[model samples]
Structures are given as C-alpha cells and as structure tokens.
Target chain A: MKSGTWRISGRETSSLPLFNTEVMGVAARRTRGRRFWSNLVNGPAARYLFILPTILFILIFLGYPLVQSIYISFTDASLLRPDVNHVGLKNYAQLLSDRLFWLSLRHSFQLTFTAVALQAILGLGLAVLLNQKVPGIQIFRNIALVTWVIPIAATVVLFSFAATPEYGLFNVLLKQIGLGDLQRYWFGNRDTAMWMIILMHVWRNAPFYALALLAAMQAIPQTLYEAAQVDGANAWTRFWVITFPYIRYTLGVMIVLHVIFTFNNFEFVFLSTGGGPVRATEVLPTYIFEQSWQYYRLGYAAAIGVAMMLILLTITLISVRLMERARRS
Target chain B: MTMRKIGYYSAVYILLILSFAFLLVPIIWVFLASLTEPRQITSGSLWPGLRSLTLDSYRRTLGSADVRIHLRNSFVIASMTTIATLLIATLAAYSTSRFARISGASITVVVLSQMFPYVLLMIPFYQLALQFNALDSYASIVFTHVVVALPFSFWMLKSYFDNVPRDLDEAALIDGCNYISLLYRVILPCAAPGLVVVAFFAFVSSWGEYMFASILSQSKQTATITVLLQGYISGRRIEWGLVSASTILSIAPTVILFALTQRWLVAGLMSGAVKE
Candidate 1:
C-alpha cells in the first residue's frame, strides 16, 4: 500500500515539475516583451513624460514671461510705439530719481508691515480663543472665515460703499457711536486713503492667519500644557514657554507669505482706490500696472517689475533660510 | 475657583463673539445694502427697515442681459480652467510622487513659480496674447488661469500622494496592473479627497481671479463678472442697488461652495500649512 502511494506521489511530483517548466517557458517569453514595454512606459523616460506637460506650461506661461519682462526692462518699449530700442539701465536710472516711485515703495512697505503685523496679533488672539472647548465655537469660527472666502472684488465694492464720504456705513456707525465729527470721505482723504486700504486688507486676510494659527495651536500636545501647569507656570509663562515655541514655525511662514502677497497686492488697491487720491495708496504693483496699461510705458513698468521681483526674491530667500534654521533647532 | 473659572470662560466667549461680529458685520451690511432701495442705501441707517428693503435689485441685476453674459463668461472660463488644472496637476503630481528621478526638480520648479510676482508676467502675457490674436477668447483666459492654479494644486496633491501607502501600489502591480491602471484603480481612489480639495481650490481661484480676466477679455461679450463689476463702479452713473446685488451674486457661488466644503477646505489648508 505504501509503494502504491509512493508511486502515485512520484507521478504527481513529476507532472508538477513538467507543468512548472511549461509555465516558466511561457513567462520567460512574455517577460521580454513586458520588460521592453515597462522600460519604455515606467522607466526614467516615463518620469519626464509625466512632468512634461506641467513643465512646458510653466515655461511658456511663467518662464517665458519672466525672461521677456527682464528683457523689456532693458529696452524702450511702449504699447503706443511699435518700434523697440535697447536702452541699457535707463529705466532703472530714471526710477532712482522718480519721486512717485520712492513714494510708492514707501507706501507699499507701510501698508504691508502694518497690515501683516495687525493680522498676526489679531489672528493669534482669535486662534487662541477658538482653541478653547466651548460650545458653538465652530459657528463663530465659520463666521470669521466668511471674510476669507468672499471674493476680493466683492470685498472691495462693499468696502468702497462703506467708505463713501456721506451716508456710508463707516460714517454712520461712527455717528451712532457719538463720533460723528470724524465723518469724512475715507478713501478721498489722502491721509486716510492708505489706512482705509490697509484696513480692508486686514479685514480680508486676518481670518486666513487665524485659521492657519488655529491649526498650529491645535497641534500642540495637551500634555505640555498640563506639565507646565503642574510646574507652577502661570498662563503668560506657559504661553511664552510652550505655545510660542510650538507656533513660531507657522508664524514665520505665515508672515513671509503675507508679506509677499501684500507687497504684490494689485487687486485690492486697484479695485478699491485705484491707487488714487493722488497716488496715496499706490504700491509697487499698482504703480507698475498704471505705468504699463494706463500710460503705455512698458519698459518703465518692466523695470519696476524687475525691481519688485528682486526685493521679493531677497525677502523669500531670507525667510526660507530662517525657517530652515528654526526647523533644525 | 469654580466661580473664577466660569467668569474666565464667559470673558473668553464674549471676546470670541465680538470678534466674529466684527468679521461678519461687513458681509451682513453688504447683504442689507443689496436688498435696500438704491437711495435708501445711502441714508446712513444702521439697518434698513422692512419698508426700505426690496427684491427689485436682485430682479434688475439678474434680469440684465449684460450681467447674464458676464456671469456665463465667468462660469465657463472658471470651470474650464478648473478642469484643465486638475487634469494636468493630477498627472504631474502622480509622477512626482511615484518617481524619484524628477521629484526634486519638479518641486523646486513649483516653489519657484510661486515666488514670481505675477504682475511681471502680465505685460509679457498680454503681448503674447496679442501676438497670437488670443485676446477676447476663453482660450487665453483659461490658459492663464490654469497656469496660476497649477503650481499650488501640484504641491497639494503631491503632498497627499506622499501620505498614501506604497504597499497598495506594489500589491496592485503584483496583481498584474499596469501603471496607468494602477493610478486610476488604486492611487486615484485613495487620493479622491485630495483631488476634490484641489478641484475646489482651482475653481475658486479662477472664479474670483480679476487680473488676467480683466486684461485679456475686453468686450462685454467676453468680460467676466469681476470686470463687469468694475465697470459698474467706474461708470458715470453708479447704481448702488444694482452694484450691491451684482456683488452678492458674484460672491454667492463661492460662499455656498465654501459652506459645503468648509471641512475639507480647512483640512486641506491645515495640512498645507503644517507640511510647509
């Protein structure tokens, strides 16, 4: 009976080997074709192919434009004149002596710093408030986020209405609160024009900072706070020691991003004031736009654009390095 | 101590509510202005009374043929831009996430693209459009919108893809699936939430975009709602009611979209911040 079983097992084993060899033969034949196709589709070439579309689009839209902008900054080109001539450093030289350019730069700095500073402070406070485990906090948070979600154009229009000299919301609210003496054309007054623009900017953007900082605040471990409390650390001390360290990275990134955005913010200033009231609110972007489109001074605008790019690039590099250093420690 | 804690909580809640009110008052004011009569809007009333409010502004703004054309143009351009951005960003993100050879270069390119002042590109883009006779066409507007939306979408999706487990890819491959099928069947399903967030972002960015849309499209035939809104503001006779109504209309879609996708949008933005 054992020999009969062995004979049966031997036949099974021999047939299995024969079957395996047949399968291997087929697989070997198929692998050659599969290998070629896979190499073509899934190899190094494939990576380039996958990224080719994005790269091509960027090159055409972003890279080409950037190069052309730089080139135009060195030439005398205007929309009105068809003929273009290369003029080395003339636009840059003119910009150095241009009072409007200096004034615009100063206004851009003033607006960006003030708005970003206010946003960071208010946003941090709001974030901490929302971080509490109170009921209906989500609703409050959503209401705050509404400003961020609203279109900038809509915000501009609404605020423009609010800032009108007579019968506007700002003046109305002030009068209701017994400050009617301060009622005036918010955007028409040169002194208040930049401030109104800055206020609008802060209103539109502070919610973004609040949301971002709230996320960072939520990520802080509960254990740290508990341990700090046990160690007799007061609220202020605990915040300085624990919360500040945790959110510093996010804060740094937010500040840099906000600065870049506010520096180049054309739409807000353009739509609201049009850098008006004698260019009181004119920043680098609006100035560039006015030069290019309104005045048809393409070369001069391109030079300003180049200058803006350099400033932005330097700030970005410095901020990135600072962030990397912070991450390391 | 319990009394003190309750007092503290109350103070915090009060402050939070006040901050929320400050943020919401502008939006509420705008809504009220939109509903009020044109003359009543300038009456300096804190809140317009029921007698002062009317739906006529909505009727008039929505009824206008010019407004309708502008709205349609905005929607078509934004939707086309969103679709094109998603398609290109998805493929590029997949490649960057899956392959090591091109990932670093691609990421660097995306980051660098973000730093370029978009104002600098406007002139060259306009010139190029003029050269190609692409002005007043959806093609030019949509193309620029896609360019603006692609870099961030690529980064967001790439980060999401990074979080997806690689085991699924290998398992699918062992099951005899090719790369393309693997993406559609495995990676895409896993990354569906990320894709939705990217799509929402693309749609909103294009929908609210003002710069290129205003520059590239000149005539009312091709102008976006934003351009039209600007026109209303800059016109000789400013109709406050109609302007307010159009403002609300232009913002309504985004507001509704935000309310619906608030959770995902918040999550996506938080992840982006943390990752950065």
Candidate 2:
C-alpha cells in the first residue's frame, strides 16, 4: 500500500508541468502519440499485422498474374507482338476444335486415373506387407521412400538411362533372360510412351501413399484385431472390417492430393518424354507450355490454361464431395 | 508350421524383396553410373565392370567451371528462397493461428491456390520479370520460387503452430512479453523440429523446379542446376557421366538433410496429411 501511494505521488509530481502549460504542451503531445503507437504495437492489431506481408505477397505476385492471365485469355497477346489485341473468345473457340488440345485433355485424364489408381493399389499392397510383423520391415519402407524424395529431373534421367534402346538396363536384362524380343525403345514406341510417364509418376508417388496409409494402419488398436480373430474372422475379413475402414480416410486424403498433383504435374512428363512419340503422352501441361512458349501463342495458351484450371477445379470439387460422402458412409 | 503357413511367409518376403528392388535399384545405379566411364555408359551397360569404376566423372564435373557456377546459383537461390519462405510463412501462420476469422480466410486462399498451375502463372512472371528488369536475376528466380513454395509452407507451418499449446502463448503475453517476442521466444523454439522439416521441404522443391528457371534463367550467371541438366540432355549426345555426376551434386544437400531428419520429416508428413 505504501509503494502504491508513492507511485501515485510520483505520477502527480511528474505532471506539475501541466500547471506550466507552455512547457508541457510539446511533451504532452509526444507522450500521447507514443501511447497510441504503443497501443497498436502491444494489442491485437499487432497479431493481424503479422499476415500483412503474406497478403501483400499473394496480391502482388500470384493474384495479379492470375488476373492478368485471365484477361490475356480474352486478348490476342503474343510475345511476338508488342500490342495485345482484344479478341472475344476466339482463343477459347479455337481450343474447342484443336485436335492436340483434345488429345492432351484426354491424355491428362488417362494419366491421372492410371497413375492415381495404380498408386493407390500398389501403395495399399506395400503398406499391408510392411505392416506385418516381419523383422527389418522398416528397412523396406525407408528405401522405398527414397524414390519419392529424389528430384523429378533425376528420376526422369535415371529411368531414361535405364530404358536406353540397345543395351540399357531393361533391354540388357531382357537379353540376359533370353527375351530379347522385348527389347525396344520403350519411350519411342507409342504404345509404351504413356505407360512410361505413368511409371515415373507411380514410382515417385506410391511410396507417399504407402507411408500415409501405414501411419493410419498403425493407429488402429491391436486388441480390435485380436477380438476379430477370436470371433473367427480370417485375415482378409479382419482387414476389410478393420484395416480398410480405418485407413480409408487417409487413403481418401492422399487420393485427393495426388489427383491434383498428377494432373498439373509437368516436370515428370516434360523431362521424361517431352510429350514424345507423336503426342501419345502429351498432356495439358506440356500442351499449354508448347503453345505459349514454343509457338508464342500467349493468348491461346492463356485460354487453354483457363480451361485446364476449370477442369482441375471441377475434378477437385467432385473428388472432395466423394471423399466427404465416403467418410459419412 | 503347416506348409501353407510357410508358403504364406515366403510369399510375403518375396514380394517385399521385389518391391524394394524396384524402388531402390535406380537410386543405387545413379551412384554406380557416376563412377563408371563415359564410354561404358554409352554402350547402355549399367555395369561397367568392377575394375572400370573410377572417380573420373566426379573429377571432370567438379573441374568444370560451368558446373561450379550452376551449383553455386542453385545453392544460393534455394537458400534464399528457403529463408524468405520461412520468414513469410512463419509470421503468417503464427498470426493466423491466433485468430479463427483470419485462418478461415487464409485456408480458402491456400485451397484455392491449388487451382492455379505454374503454367498459368508462367506468362505473367515472364512479362513481370522483363518489366522489372529482373530477368536473369537471382532475385527474380528466388521471388518466383518463394511464391511457389509459400502456400504449402504456410499450411505446414500453420499446422505445426496449432500443435503448439496456446496456454504458453497466453502465459508469455501475461508475463509482459510482446506478441512478436512470444512467437520468437516461445512458439518458434517449440516448433523447431517442424521448422527443420519445412526447411528441407522448401529447399528440395526449389532445387527441383525447372519450368520457370528454364525461361527466366537465360544466362550463365543465373542458371540453376536443373537448368544445367536440361541443357545437357537437350543436346545431341547427353554425357551420361556428367549428367550422373551433376545429379549427385543436385541431390547431395537433400540426401544429407534427409539422412539427419528422416524421422522428423516422416512424422511431419504423417501429421500433415492425416490430421484432418
């Protein structure tokens, strides 16, 4: 109580300049300004200020470019020309009839489905195998994950080297096994070109799925499995009843993420095949790039990009809806 | 055990072995090919004989000035991008973590970000760089990469920050700690492991990126390692030995980071994906 009274006395004495109004005017205003500034600095306003940089970054770098891209889709803006001519839906109309565009759209679906499906299946299998109480099981899982960590460029080059025409690893192995008939330019052949793209994607993404599903599998109670076995449920029955249901959400999450990734993925396809063997492996990403960068059809490429974005948006919504339904059911 | 039981165990082991080989052989082959002679590589032979193995590719690749410049550019750009991403993402994540209204708003942005492919963003970036006279500049590449890496980084960091207890944040604030100090002194140290994982993530993505670098990095001064590899492959004859050696160099940082932080990274991935 004595310290409090002393602090009050100190404040009252310090305010004696108030009686000498001329001397206190500037100092009083400065203190008022400082208090306001400190109030902002020490309040909830400061917390919201933290995201100001992020918001400004998005608005300037990402959002502005996106808005410009959408606008360019409606204009005949080519890098070859200095002026951007306003063309009303001409680019979009052209995309409707463009053969390569449709082929690419079709191939995009093909790759996304084939790769996602294969990854889900392969991942489930590997997760199940590794989930078994085998000694050194972690070694298998860890090595598999290495495929996912390496860069896309490295993976492409590694596979490309392995698939070299004459005596590459795949062909050489074929020769050693007395099946030289299978030896050919795997990527050059139209039939196998798309598969090669899918192979690289699956090789990279499947382990990710496996890891997710395995984590989910580990969270299930061991006693639940024991109870199921006591009830005469076999291994397959127990898995379908317990393991499958438990990991379904993780599987769903992975599927949604991977679908977006595979559909928009350019590096793997671009590096591995360059949409080669006469457009057999051409997808929307490479097609968009070729039209814009190679042909300088900036306006046209923007239109295609707009279209691709809508397709991705639609697919994402549908999958998310389906995932929600799966969770409910 | 019955014969059927023995068969089941044997089959499981066989499948495991085959799957592991499929996944691991390519990574192992990169190291082997890096040591093999260029001529042996040209013959489509993965095995260059035990005696033919040498450090010749490493010596040549390291000796090349071109490789050195690219390695430097790649490291600098990736490091810059990582630092920038962590700074922006951490502050945004921490602030947004404190408020429901703002985080809800930012989550929409993050999800919506998934819609814009790099190809869509490519033209504007090209033109923007040119307009700003930042073309062929490290700042341009680093800026583009930071933007690219931001959304995922923000999401991951936000999740990690959420995992940090809020009681501590309140206690610090109650003890006369300012908002910024609370984040730096309290929250960040708690989330240090997550920070390392996110750093590895940001670095790896920047190191691997190609499309923008291919266009923006037009000169020797700014080309990243991926661009260097692209140049080697686009030529008539790819020097496999050089490419392999370059690949080793490109992935070396990630290999070391992963070797040290594999456990932390795995946990981060699991928690990020499966949490909700």
Candidate 3:
C-alpha cells in the first residue's frame, strides 16, 4: 500500500476495508442505492458484473446474428423484393444443383488445400534455413515477417504492382529476360488468376509459418542435437530424428489457424480478382458476398454462408482430432 | 567438417537472401512507386529514376474530401473497436482467470466462434444492422469490428491474466482491495502490455476489414478506408501512383502500430494460441 501510486483518487472509502460492515451499516442507514453499488463493486456480485458485459456483447452481437442467419437462410429474402417468404431450404436445394455454386465450393477447398500445403512446405524449408547459425539471419527473418504485417487490402495493392498488364513489374522483368511474350495479365487469365490468388496467399502467409515453426525449432533442446551429432548423425539425420518431432505441434496449430483464415478469407480473392477471369478465383466467401451485394440475393447468400459454416466446422473438428492424436504420441 | 559447415551456411545465406527478396520486392516497389509521378507508372516506367521521385501523387490523393471521409471513418471505427474490445475483453478475461466457473464454457464458445465462417455472419449482421436502422452508422460498424477482434483479444488478455501471479491478487485481497479495485489497481497494470497489444490488434483488424464494411456501411459516410481503396485497386489503366499513395496512407496507421508493438504482439499471440 505504501508503494501503491495507483491511488490517484485517494478517496476516503478507497482506503477503507473493502467489505466494511460499518460502512455497509452507514450506507444501509443512509440509502439503499448506496448499499447496492458498494455491494455491486466491492462485494461478490462484482464477479457477475465482470462477466456481464462479455456475455451481453456475445449474446447480442454473435448469438443474435447467428440465429438470424439460420432463420433467413430458410426464407426467400431479397433486398430488392419487399416480402421475405419462408421457402424451406429452397436456397440450399438450388445451391446444390447449381453448377457455379459447386465450382466455387471446389475452388474454395482447392485454394485452401493448395495454399496451406505450399505454405507449410515452403514455411518448413524457410524455418530450417533461418534456424541455421548464420550472421544477419535475424535481419532476414524480420524482412520475411514484413509480408505478414501488411494487411490484406494493402497486400492486394502491392501484388497489383506486379499484376497490372503490360507495364507491371513482372511483365517488365519478363521482357528483360527475353520472355516478353510470356508476360501475363495475371488476374485476367483463367489459368493464372487462381494461381495469382494462391501466389498472393502464399506470399502473405508463409512467413508467419516460418516464424512460428522457427520458434518451435528454437525451443528444442540443443543437447539433443549435440548428442545426435556426437553419435555421427548428419544434418539431415539430426533434423529428421530430432527437429521434426518438436516443431510438429506448432506447425499443426499454425496450419489450422491459417486454414480457417484462408477458408473464410473474403478480402484477398474479392479485392484481388473480384472472383473474375470468368469466376476462376471465385471462392465461397466471395461468391456469397457477390450474391448478397451485387445480385441482392440475400437468402441465397445466407444458404451459401451456412454451407461455408458447415465446411469450416468440419475442418476445425478434424484439426482438433489430429492435434489430439499427435499430442498423445 | 569445417568446409562442409561453411558450404552449408553459404547455401542457407543465399536461400535466405532470395526469400527476403521475394517477400520484399513488392513492398519496396510500393514505397518507391508511391513517390513517382502519376504519369510515370502508367507510361511503362514502373521503376522511375530516384531523381524523378516526387510526393505529388500523395499530395493530390490526400486533398480529396472523399478520401478524407473514408480515413475518418476508419479512424472512428478502429478507435471505438480498440476501446470497446479492451474494456469488454479485459473484464471477461479477468473474471475467467479468477473464477473457473465461467472459463470452461467461455473458452469453448470463444474458440469455436472464431471458426464460424465470417461470411456466414456477414449477411445476418447486415440484416441486423438494417433491422435496427444502424446502416451507415458508426455503431453498426464498430459492433461488428468488436466481434471480429473479441475472440483473439479475449484469448490474449485471458492468457496475460492467467500468467499474473495469484500472489498479487491474494495480497490485494488481504489489503482489503476488492476484486474491482484489485483488477483496476494491480491486474490491469500488470496486464497493461497485453492490453496495448490487443488494442493494436483490434485497431489493425478493423482497419483492414472490407466485407462487413462494404455491407453494413454502404454509403461513403461510414465506409472504411479499406473499402475506399477497393475502388482504386482495380487493374484499370488508372494512375497506379495515386492508388499506391492512398494505400500507403491507409496502411500507415497499422504499420506504425505494428512496429511499436511487434515484440509483445508476437510473443503474446504465440503463447495465446499454443495454450489452446
């Protein structure tokens, strides 16, 4: 209490014992309102008060929206049309039959799988390299993380520096390398558009994996590696026998984190490609956003949104199970 | 052995350099391109000479009232989100840390909620906004941004509180400081660094959000800077320099915040996630 400088107000009551029955008695004699507040703040009720705001925020903000989403998905709701009729899974039925919907769903998973796989592989490689006892590696590690720091919107704009047609950076570089004919309008070509989206995803996320995995690698006991080296284990053998086991948990967690992230990712595809080049890069989130906003098909968008929820739920469960299995071993 | 070690390190150094270049080329170009004259980017001179660099594009981009409104919108939303997330998440985190009754269900809900497909939440949130006539209002956008930041902020702050030695809390209680006083006086001050990181995380997430902003705040009145940049971010033959300048401006706040808070942010985030 002597060193407590936080007593900025220094009220007389602040110095008093928190649950003073005498103060409660004085408050009880003075007014019921005073007793309530003191009990509210200073008494056991403060525990509920501490939790009240979060519960209220979650219930009103998250719970309500969720309930409204499932409800609206069953209705024929459109912003353009006034009436919202209960259509009973008509939107989902249409979605299942719709070729474009399936295509976008497939694209979503394809993009997620490809990007996650590539990022993990590339990330592990980068992590191994970065873990070496080389000078200036810290600077390189920081530079690598710069990609993760730039937000999604800015990342799109940065990639557009190379994505713009004839005058873009990649095209210009191509010309210098005598591959001017191979210069591509990346987001415009169907084959390249999806790849461009993947490229951007990898460019932005791989370093995060590297950072996490490197931290995991660094956490491993150095004596284990030293012991292996003394037993004539080579670099490859040491990494396989020692390094891989330790970093797997961090790697698994990072992969799941990014998987959910990339799956629900709307900004990257929507901003970069707008699901264009004939919808080659169209993923579930972008598809739903387009349906809701551009087409004003609210009910249909909600159905797709619900489908997205289901897929994400499954991925999360499977990842959890995998993590548990790994932990047990 | 020495020669093999040197050879191995040389390869590692080369790969590291290439990786850095791959990651940084666009970032370096954005900085350089934001300085070039608007005409140079469109005319195929993507890399302008250092002597020709100018801030003309940045000057012109900032002069627009539309951009100013969008920037203000982002600032208002992000600020509200930071303050709200800090207050709500910290309180909940403290309660959960001290009381085990709420921790089990709360942690489960919070973690599951993160995987709830943001797009799934988008339309319902949109309808909720329209239903309450909160469309284009700062309250509507700020509410949604808080939701986005809540899970992570809650986790981060909870872990920070968890790590706070219980001895401090007991000492405060013995000194007659109630839970509220103990939290405000001892726990919060100890977790102040975590609060800073969560606040910055909330600010950055809300600033960069686009889908919710586009839906809930359709009009320019409440559209965030991210939405504003979307209009100029296309591949049209427009002045790339202007777009670059606006982007740099929009991202400046987050970049500055990240630079200031990177150490605590990275360490806290790693520990927070792994604890799950």
Candidate 4:
C-alpha cells in the first residue's frame, strides 16, 4: 500500500502541470487580484519569508548580543554606573595580569581535557561492550542514559550527597569495601574538588558519546571483523585495525563537541562546588559569572567572555572542517 | 578456546554490570534519601529500611509556596521557549532544506551558533535586559532560552526535513497549495517524529537550563526550579531531605519524557551526528 502511494506521488510530480491556475476559478483569481501577487507570494521570495523569522530572531538575540559583548569588553562599563567610556586594552590587560583569571583559564583547560578524555575512552569501551550480541544489553544502555536525561541541577545534588565527607554514600561504599582511607571530602578538599566535578561531568556525558558511537559501530559491516579474525588477528588487533578506524570520525566529532560543552558548562560546576575550596574549581564560566555579578566588573568579565568566545570559535571552525571532511569521506 | 570464550564473556558481563551499577547507584541513593528522614539522610546509611521511608519530604517540599512558584515559573519558561524555538526552527529548517541558495549559509550559521558560549551572551543580555527594563520577566528568560535552544534545534530539524521526500511538496503544489500551506499540511505532518525530536530538545534544554535562568530571573517571583534547587545547595543550613525530594521532582518530568522517547531521541542524535 505504501509503495503504491509512493509510486503515484512520484508520477504526480513528473506529470503535474506548472502553476495550474485552472484549479482556481476565474472568480477566485479575480478576487485575489492578479497572478503577480500570488506568484510573488509563492515564488522564491516565499523561501526567504519562511526563514526570515529565524534570521531576524538570531540577529536580535544572538548576533546583536555577541557584537555587544565584544564591544562591552573594550569599554569601562560596570553595573554600578550606566555610563560607559572606551578603555582600549585595559580590560584585556587586567585579565592577563589577574591571577584568578589565569587560574580559571587553566581550570577550564584541565576540566575540558580530563572530562572529554575520560568520556571518550570510557564511551568507546561501553560502545564496544554494548555492540556485542549480549542479552539485555539494551536495558543497560538505557539505564546508562538516565544520567544524561536528568537535569544537571539534580545530578549536582545527588553527587554532592554522595561526596559528603562524614556520611556520604561514597565514603560509606569505600569503607564497606575496606578502602576507607581512600575516602575524603570530595568537593570540599581542594585536591579532589575539580576531579570530582570532572567525574560528575564524565558520568553525565559519557553515555551520549557511547550511544552515538554505538550507532556508528552498528553501521560497520560485520564482514570486516570476520575478515580480521580470518586473518588471525587477535581481539586487540581486530579492535585497533577495524573497529577503531570505523568510529574515529565519530570520535573526533564527539571530542570537539565535548570540548565545547565542557568548556562552557556552568551549572554542573556552579551547583556542585560553586567553584569553591579557595577557587580550586573555578572554571572560566563561573569566573565570568563572579566577576560580572559578584564584583560588578561587567567590562572585565566581558573581556574574559570574549577570550573564551575566541578560543571556542577557533575550535568550532576546526570542527566544521572535520565534519565536512568526514561527510565527504 | 571455548573456555577462553567463556572467560571473555564473563569479563564483559562483569564490566557492563559494574558500569551500570556506577551509573544507577547515585540515582538510587538520591531516591532513597528523598524518602528517608532528614536526620537519616545526614547520617548517611546506605539504605533506609522500608519502614523508615516516608513521603514527608515530598510533602514538605511540594507544600512550600516557594517551590510551587519556582516550579510554575520553570514550566512557563520552558514551555514558552520550546514553542518559540520550534516555530522559528521549523520554518528555518524547511527553508534551508528546500532552497539551494539559503541552505549553505543557513547550515553554517546554525552550526557556528553552537560555539558561541552562553556566558558571553549573558553579559550583554543582562545589559540589554536592564536597558529595556526586562529583568525578572518571563519575556527576558524565555527569549534567551529560545536563543539557547535555537541552533541545535534548527540543525536537527533541518536534518529531519531533509529526510522528507520533496515529491510530496510538488504533489501539493499541483493541488494549488502554496509553500506555506504545503509546509503546514504536508511536510510538517510527515516530519512528526522529527518535530517531536526538536520539541523534546528545545523543551529539555530550557527545562534544565540554570545559568541564564539564575542570572536573568533574580527575584523569587521569576526564579526557576533549578534556581531554587541551587538555593538549597548554597544555603548555610542544608536540608538534605528537602533537597533530595525537590531534585527528584525537578527531574521527574524530563526523565519520564526521555524514557518514553528514548528510541526516537537516540535515533535523532545518531542521524544528526552521522549526517552532519
């Protein structure tokens, strides 16, 4: 039935008359006042009409704000006073000299690399595991995605509960496993704070990569693996030679995406540690937040924001090129 | 060889189980904590016996006027943002998918827009809001949330639209249907699953959003559930019971929606990744 309808529709396009004004009565055409108006409304101009709303919206909300943010970075602006004056490179210079700014930058890089690396590796492992013809694997995959589905705020709350020092679930588990000494204040301790946030991030995001890679892995022909096995390739060799190559493009895309997301992630760090324990977890986003809202240094924060944008812009361009290459190949 | 195969299978099963446990334990722990007494949660027992479990925390949290307000605000903002985003994104996706000239520029804009960090936009948005006297208003937050959800939604929906057969458009055109009516009558209905995916993306993005919600909606009147949840964490005297219950409540909608739509969601994500 579906195929019959599809065939009919296929023929209709090839056989249908162009601009069949006969379908509309002469009276209706007279009421509508000339074919020019109808043609204009229904022609190429109509395509622009469809997209104009979105373009206008982006211009107002995204494009304008971006330009404004860059402009604000160069001026001496603060929440305290409505007036603004051009300050040249003062904000950028201040950001360069600011110890906290440098620290936050370092933290952003550390968090992005560590979290993305962990997520990629673990996600690939999970994808490989789930790709096996194991019974009930789909259930496990769905369960793994629960963290990704839940709100970051909720995840932060749960992790904070687990990380509580004295009686947290993490400590209790460690003690139960006779690794009691390994347990410490996860969020409160400076040494472990950033790592805990990274752990939380990986836990929430790895499933995304896992699911995406799993889909890609499923698309790979089974004959490739069979051929590798016939060639006497071991399990490790089979993975490295066949599986890894098949998913590398996807892996690259996910890595770039993860970098962008982790670098800009605000709520996970904000809600969990609030970039606390003496700024040990202060990433760029939270730093910008504090500088702008807490200290009312709007211009300085905008400068930092601009720096973050420029870095991400470069990564985005590279990602676009990679995606294009992947698409072609 | 059979023995080695058995060993390999067992190891894989064990690792899979362990990973599942790692992901599930925190959620299960939070669920248990939400049901336990406040003192018991602080005491941090691995489990609260069935007898110790009570609904008082959920009751108290839900009974609070502040939580109610925040919940309402979150619903309003997220729903509005989803509607606005879908409206704009659907049109844009349709235009790009059908038109040659617009496709290249539109796709690039959509992809590039994702890299603009929301933090940068927040500074200027705040200033704009202040100038327009739009702070603490639904319009301010909803507008920003729409922008936040737009880029990805547009891309995903465009991919969905691409899957739709263009032959149907020609068929409708022959029936005297114009572009607008054709999109309304033919393309959108056929792309229902894609629309669902886009709507879910927009809804969830705005639902869980915190940064813009916190910054824009400062007053309690406009605060979202996420903002209220942050208050629970940042407060000097933490109420673990209330926090757990509220956290569960805050996420329940999204979790339920996700569970119901996991298949479509995963498929959408896969196509978006591979196709792009």
Evaluate model 3 with DockQ and give the value. Answer: 0.48
In the range A68-182, model 1's lDDT, one tens digit per residue, is: 8889999999989999999999999999999999999999999989999998999888888888887788887765677877778888888888887667788898999999999
lDDT of 1 at B65: 96
Interface RMSD of 4: 2.9
Candidate 4 lDDT over residue span B158-232, tens digit each: 898888897787778767777678888999998888888888888888989988888899798899999999989
lDDT of 3 by residue, B1-276 (tens): 599888988888788878888888887777788888776765566468877799898888888898899999999998999999999999899888885356779877887677676876776787788889999899999999999999889988999998888878767776667667789999999988888878988988888888788888878999988888888865455568778888889868877887788777666667776666
- lDDT tens per residue, model 3, A198-276: 9999998898888788888888999998899899999889988899988888989888888888888888998888899
Model 4: lDDT to the true structure: 0.84
Per-residue lDDT of candidate 2, residues B1-276 (tens digit): 899988888988999989888887777777788999877776656477988799999999999999999989989999999999999999898878764347667876887777787777778888899999999999999999998889888888888999898778656754555567778999999999778878888888898888888889989899998888878876787788998898888878777777777878877877766665
Per-residue lDDT over A160-188 for candidate 4, one digit per residue giving the tens place of the 0 to 100 score: 88987767899988988889898887999
At residue A239, candidate 4 shows an lDDT of 86
After TM-score superposition, the amount by which residue A231's alpha carbon in candidate 3 deviates from its true location, in angstroms, is 1.6
Where in model 2 is the C-alpha error above 4 Å?
Answer: A1-37, B1-9, B43-46
Higher-DockQ candidate of 1 and 2: 1
TM-score, second chain, candidate 2? 0.94
lDDT of 2: 0.83
Candidate 3 Cα misplacement greater than 4 A, ranges:
A1-32, B1-5, B43-46
Misplaced by over 4 Å in model 1 are: A1-40
Candidate 2 C-alpha error for residue A42, in Å: 2.0
